[model samples]
Target: MKQLPPEYYALLEELQAVDFVLVELTLYLDTHPHDYDAIQQYNQFAQQRGLLKKQIESKFGPLQQYGNSYSGYPWNWDDAPWPWQV
Candidate 1:
């Protein structure tokens, strides 16, 4: 079986936190759609998640590029060490 990179775990943790914040803000916005503070905070956190996602992709290759690249360094989805090995 293939192992995930260490950064994968870190990114997953961050993604989870961001997901929670997004969900909470979504619920809050449902009742207070015009609340500027909540909207701003949600936007901020959403941007943070985007940045983290980009970082992960840059380091690990595109998540959806499952076929693996073969030019310089092989984008080894099959052999890229586990999350604990980052």
Candidate 2:
């Protein structure tokens, strides 16, 4: 595989970790609905993920083709490298 820039990998790794935490918290909340602390943690991570996604989109481009993440001129999504390719 081609090597991506270190910052790209770092941002992706952090996003993945935040997403994992959010998923696990969701599962936990499904069983323990009254756990306010866990709910707060989940919300915090969700916010972090959103901010990180925005940063990623700004620096790299849309993470998806059909969503609001698209920006810039000439609709370059088709020309940018895919995540797995880098």
Candidate 3:
């Protein structure tokens, strides 16, 4: 892997945290569908997640592969096994 700025990892952690919250909210909404406050929070967090993703991709590269991300260069989608892969 190429060297990445500290901010990359920081932003990535932020993204992960937000995604976690989204997942929790989704689960909560599944059980408490009438909670308007939770729904609003979920939508707001979802938008924030989108912005963070775009910022990361714009500065570094795609957070995912397949059709979920776009790249101008062939290597933007890492050819190597992902860090999460063993």
Candidate 4:
């Protein structure tokens, strides 16, 4: 695998942390559907995740092999280095 810059790993770590919180909140909400506080927290985390994803894509590239991240030029998604390889 290719070595990625520290910033890339940092952003990925931050996003992973947000995703972990979201998963936990989801599991809690599954049993206590009316937990308003948890619901709000989940929404906040979800928003954070989206913003983080955008940041990562803008700075590095698409996180997935296919999706909205694709755009003009010589197909960036196809050229962007994979996380594991970077």
Candidate 5:
């Protein structure tokens, strides 16, 4: 198996954590649409998710096919299985 830097793993975990929180908040907001606090929390977590995705891509590489995989640059979908492959 390939080994990645510890920080990459940490960032991945943080991203997952943020996603989970966002999911929970979404569910809560669905049932309580008027709860402004939950809506704010959900929006914050969504932004965090986007930022984490950008950070991971900037630090490591693209995590999917849509991220510069075919933008006349080198193909990177198969570059780092250590961080994405299970």
Candidate 6:
């Protein structure tokens, strides 16, 4: 199995944190859109998450894809050596 670089692992963790923040903020905003502070914070994390996603995909692979073969890069998410393997 192949091992991911330290940066990739760190980025993965950061992405997870960003995702959690996004989900929580999304749920909160669903009924409280007037919370400008929350909205701004959500947007900030969302943007960071987007950029991290691209960075991950560029180095590792796409976690999720959009449309039919019309995005992302060439990654080996199908085979062995999952994230925890390293």
Identify the leading candidate in terms of TM-score. Answer: 3
How high a TM-score does candidate 2 get?
A: 0.83
Error of 1 at 77 (Å): 8.8
Report the error of model 3 at residue 21, Å.
0.4
After superposing candidate 2, which stretches have Cα over 4 Å from the reference? 1-3, 84-86
> Candidate 2, 2: how far from true, in Å?
8.4
Error of 1 at 76 (Å): 8.7
What ranges in model 3 sit over 4 Å off? Answer: 79-86
Better of 2 and 5 by lDDT: 2
Candidate 6 local accuracy as lDDT? 0.76
Q: Tens-digit lDDT track for model 5 on 1-78?
A: 556788888999998899899889988988999999888888898999888888888777776574432322475565
Which candidate, 1 or 4, would have the higher TM-score against the true structure? 4
Mind giving the per-residue lDDT tens digits that candidate 6 earns over 1-86? 56567998898899899999999999999999899999999989989988887787677765664532223344445644444564
1-86 per-residue lDDT for model 3 (tens digits) = 46677887788888889999999999999999999999999999999999998998888777677777767476656543342431
True-vs-predicted CA distance for residue 20, candidate 1, Å: 1.1
Candidate 4: Cα lDDT at 83: 62
Give candidate 1 misplaced runs (Cα > 4 Å). 63-86
Residue pairs with clashing backbones, model 2: none
Candidate 2 vs candidate 4, TM-score winner: 2
**How do the predictions measure up, each by TM-score?**
0.66, 0.83, 0.86, 0.81, 0.81, 0.75
Write one digit per residue (lDDT tens) for candidate 2, span 1-86: 33458999799888889989999999999999999999999999999999998998788777766665775687766754666565
lDDT of each: 0.71, 0.82, 0.81, 0.81, 0.77, 0.76
Question: Residue 78 in candidate 1 has what lDDT?
Answer: 54
How well does candidate 4 match the true structure in TM-score terms? 0.81
| lDDT of each residue in 1-86, candidate 1, tens digit only | 45665767778688778979999999999999999999999999989977876776666655434344332256455555443344
Which has the better TM-score: candidate 2, or candidate 3?
3
